[model samples]
Target: MLNRALRLPTRAFVQVRSPRGAFDATLGNLSAAGARLVGIPERTIIVGDWIGIHCVGQNYSAEVRWHFDDTCGLMFEEPLSEYQIMTILGSRVAL
Candidate 1:
């Protein structure tokens, strides 16, 4: 059970609330199980920390699985469905 899942790159602005504080980030890419968050600006987030991610009017509870170079990977507490993923990506697409 170790196949690398597909990821769709995105560039939506979002807010992340962690133990350190809330800050902005880019939704770099996404999949059903997790996502890549870029442009953290600050490197305060650490692995094993649970963070709340707010994007496009939706809130997601995710764990900071890895972090480095002002970027982090988040594993969603509950995997998102395909419909939800497409909806999220579509909402931010410029016309």
Candidate 2:
């Protein structure tokens, strides 16, 4: 079977907190299972680190899967439901 997860390009500011530190980052895209974070401070988040994200009135924990330059990929510990993805896409008042 094909993958059922959905991914979408997005632009939003979100908070990311890791054991190393907290950063102000831009969310490049989002999905039910993971997200791509952009513009992270160099050396703040490395691969295999656990981080927390505050986005769209919700908080999620994710693991850093990859890192390159100023961007990295995160896989959520608990995947967001489909409803949450859509809500994040449409929400403008959320920061």
Candidate 3:
């Protein structure tokens, strides 16, 4: 079993980059390894699709792991450091 990182609930706008182009998404929760994106349109994304997520001027490469309704889970290509996560969150709130 994989150990889950601690997730912090947040409301921030995130940019999702796919082969088609970039789309706006809502960051509902965040962690070092993954995040929950809400308000994405249904059928717009699929599992295993590689994507880039941008928030607060920070970027992360990730893969789509799961989706339900308008929400999807993304697993980062590399786990983010705690400091990086905090910086993104701090900047988000500061905006």
Candidate 4:
């Protein structure tokens, strides 16, 4: 499914922390609104639940929009700076 609503597609790592615990995974695709995070094998997050996420060294609040085994989409609560976004994308691409 193509989320055409997002203009820019980037890649970054997403850090998710909930009541359960904390985990980090690569978000292979990103946008200003949300991101498609990969490498997550756990299903402890719930949709619409607020979470703390770190990407490109910048931390932000986000909510779980959707998820599946090893993959998920998180909607950011705040807008990220262009530099931050680019840095995240670059770092992920390099890996």
- In model 2, the runs with Cα more than 4 Å from the true position are 1-4, 92-95
lDDT of 1 at 72: 91
Q: What residue runs in model 3 are displaced by over 4 Å at the alpha carbon?
A: 1-3
Clashing pairs in 2: none
Looking at candidate 1, the ten consecutive residues that score lowest on lDDT are 86-95
Please write out the lDDT profile of model 2 over residues 1-95, one tens digit for every residue: 88756669888778899889998888889987899999999779889999999977788899999999999999999988888887777763553
TM-score of 2: 0.87
Indicate the residue-level lDDT of 37 in model 2: 94
Worst 10 residues of 4 by lDDT: 2-11
Computed on alpha carbons, the lDDT of every model, listed in order, comes to 0.87, 0.86, 0.84, 0.71
TM-score of 4: 0.76
Whole-model lDDT, candidate 4? Answer: 0.71
Compose the digit string of candidate 3's lDDT tens values, residues 1-95.
98778999888788888766678888888898889999886567888899888887788898999988999998999998989888767755634
Residue 11, candidate 2: C-alpha displacement in angstroms: 0.5
Which prediction has the highest lDDT against the true structure? Answer: 1
Please say which candidate is ahead in lDDT: 1 or 4.
1
lDDT of candidate model 3 versus the reference: 0.84
Off by over 4 Å in 4: 1-3, 7-11, 93-95
